[model samples]
Target: MKHLSPKQKASIALAALRGEKISKLSSDYQVHPNQIGKWKKLAEEELAVLFTDKRKKENHSQERIIDELYQTIGRREVEISWLKKNSSLSYPERLTLANKEHPDISTLRQAELLDISRSSIYYQPTVNPGDIQIMNSIDKIFTQCPFYGHRRIKPELKEEYGINIGKKRIISLMKEMGLNAIYPRPKLNLSSSDKQHKKFPYLLKGLPIIRPNQVWGTDITYIKLKKYFAYLVAILDWYSRYVVAWKLSPTLENIFCIQALEQALKINKTEVHNSDQGAQYTSLNYINILEESEIRISMDGRGRCMDNIFTERLWRTVKYENIYLNEYADIGEAGQGLSEYFKFYNEKRRHQSLDYKTPAQIYFAKY
Candidate 1:
């Protein structure tokens, strides 16, 4: 009738099992006779299970453990075999490992396991040998005629090299190479404009650039590399055609433009700094630097390349004199080649407009 320990219950049940009467055991243990009967019934039902054979169950448990161990060993073996096949291999070599002819693994599954794209497994890239020659010819054409758009370039391509091509394809290649006509055009893509940034007026329109520090103009141009293109930003002294500072970047980020500005300011401070309406020049950071230096900020009117006339001319001179002369393999190679070229440009190359005087001679005339 009251709470009883498991030991007490088991003892009562044992007495019942030993042929002792449940009513006598109940009276002896102070438990109800009905409670003793319930305990005895439970023990009798479970006693058979306690004495039954367990070897079969043990053997079954052992077999399951052995199966799991075998599965783990198989997984490790597959991993080891894969590593042995692909160890220390290059990406192209590893790509050859995915076989569509394999019986078990499909191409998709093999690609996923190899951490590569399924398309890459089957897609073979073929380069058109004529593209390089055509691009080089295009570069020469663009260098000679900066104002030629894709419409004009199409004919020039056919006339110059007999390489007849469509307008759309030429436009795509020009876009990729970052080339556009230098004439006053509606859309300029080299530098994009952000609607959020502040736009400034063109201040060099009537201003006389009499000396080295009177006005400095900056612009970005694309230099063709062996495989791709690189962007070059330069700050030029308008009056002397002296390159104050130049930076080459793989991107069109404002940081590189700002760095070029910083470098120019370090060399000599100009009274006015001019650039296109491109976002790189109008960016808050670029504006802040010019404002901080007390230099007047001037931006070309939208679609006006001549607003920064000296820099545009500088780009032409750079391409014809140096860029077109050398085949730069990479950015580093281009940088090195451009460094020497700019050195020659500033120190040795004489400008007919500058009375045959070099930029260094004019820039450092007073010094």
Candidate 2:
């Protein structure tokens, strides 16, 4: 007999079901009546299964489409991560992609995965440059004495800078700039009030950092731009004084802190990650990242113990050498300027502490 497609066989089966004579149909199609009878009976027996199989095929197709979508998502994530590490894309641009809404992952977590900061995610170039001169004066004061709160800053602004800004305005601007007049003393302390959460004690008081990734320190500081101001968060390898990752944001949010952390972890997860008890470090999102990685969490006491001293020293270096010298025009210019600065800092600028060796040299060679 001739080969018949399922459709043709189904047509014949339907004909027989409609009371067509089995012998007549077989004779017309040039097939035996017995084969015709079997086809008809089999089709009748599994008619329901045919409908079921169509549904199954549709389900299979849907699953295939979903799989393709997942693969596409995965590819995009990889591309974004690569761009974050390798591209000329600014810090804020990298943060923008990584800091997005996700169902399972928090935006902060996404920022970390992309290796960008959360604060940078929403940074706008629009400058409200309240008082550029005043803010710069404030920057110098805060840089000199970070322990001075707004109340103390107001007096210095009047006495030293000859600006009589109110304390409230100073408070507001300091808050806007993410600069808190850290009480007690500056340069190695912050407060976290989580009594239930396990807080590690200050681990780098007098201990000598022997290698890269032995203890990683992170901190946030304000950056003075030409018109507007921005905040900078950086992670440093304490031993080598290497800036592992750094980001600048218009505000002081923890996501950028998380982003810096994420970038550093990508290179090498450190044994201990140290920071002040600022909201960012104390945040559940940030804590979880370190906790999950099995990294020891070290927090400076509220008093004076020099928790992240290496990172504090870096801020002085960055400001004195690069940030102050350039006076970046805007966030875009600032981003570009800082990028070049960090590159030079890591690759070119030799440190007196490291015997005139660059951070990259000590971080890569001896370790």
Candidate 3:
């Protein structure tokens, strides 16, 4: 009784499945016909499972990564919540806790994770009480009308709130507050003209988005908190206007943007992904994720906000509906509030553009 190798057994089994006569396989392999038949039956029983096992492995890996991320998020949330709860400690005091020599996280990330701006870490200028009032007014105005720039806001400030503030002051304050007007700017591509970051052209032009996963538009917007602001990045399905995934970060770092994209991929992949020419969207790591997913990359042209219009609309909706109304006390509050708001936005809020159907309804209609 000569022992057969696994490779030889597989070869014999393949031949059997290919319709070769069992007697011929047994003769070619110099094995008993019954042994050949057993191998063929085993292969037949396990062949389908081979492919299934591969998929299960991939899914398990993905699930493990997602679980790790959730754990990190939960731990980070606890730390941030503790910091926020201690109102006696100023942001400057919190900034001092960032260790420069930290191995895992950088100082910049530490500042962001602590919900303090990097610039504020170095220079904690005493802000005037009046300036805060003016900034709050500006936030309100910007939330309602994102297209309003300093020039437009100056007049609105005088007219709406009757706050007679100088244009230079408004400009400086808006810059410090990171409240840039959302409008088209010509030659914006030249800003990203550096060799490192490459920009893609708008691919959604004249293309109809007819299904849930046909196109996904993503963008980052500022969410106003009581003391500071956080950035919100979201990926939305263009056809159903469903928010696939969203992340709130205290900083404008590309990591949050990449996280949102990765989370959305875990839900479902899109044929084409559209985004603005912001550094977050054009960053190498962010672009690599989309490219690895085989998604067609589409970028807004020269500060054309309308190219990723659906995401822009999503920001406006989120702000007006949930953000401005509450004016979240801190990042901890903002995160919890946004979690609920997004659930409502997806599951309850009806959109007229969707023929008065909720985003969840339209998104899951095919399923």
- CA lDDT of each prediction against the hidden true structure: 0.75, 0.72, 0.72
* Model 2 vs. true fold: TM: 0.66
Clashing pairs in 2: 117-256, 118-255, 118-256
TM-score list, all predictions: 0.62, 0.66, 0.63
For model 3, the local distance difference test gives: 0.72
What is the descending lDDT order?
1, 3, 2
| Model 1 stretches astray by more than 4 angstroms | 1-135
Candidate 2, residue 351: Cα displacement in angstroms equals 1.5
Off by over 4 Å in 3: 1-132, 176-183, 186-195
What order do candidates take by TM-score, descending?
2, 3, 1
Over 4 Å off, model 2: 1-88, 93-128, 147-152, 180-198, 303-305
In Å, residue 328's CA in model 1 sits off its true spot by 1.3
| Predicted model with the maximum lDDT | 1
lDDT string for model 1 (1-367, tens) is 6566796688668779998755334433446677788898999998878657877666667878799899879766765677677665433345557787766555644653554445555654343546667777887897778778888989889997999999877876665555667666655376557889898888877777787799999998878767665678999999899999987766664656766787788899999888887877876667877887899988888767768778888988999888888888766578768888889999998889988999999999933
State the lDDT of candidate 2 residue by residue for 233-298, as single tens digits: 889988888888987776655556666777788898899988877767876667767877899888
In model 3, pairs of residues that clash are: none
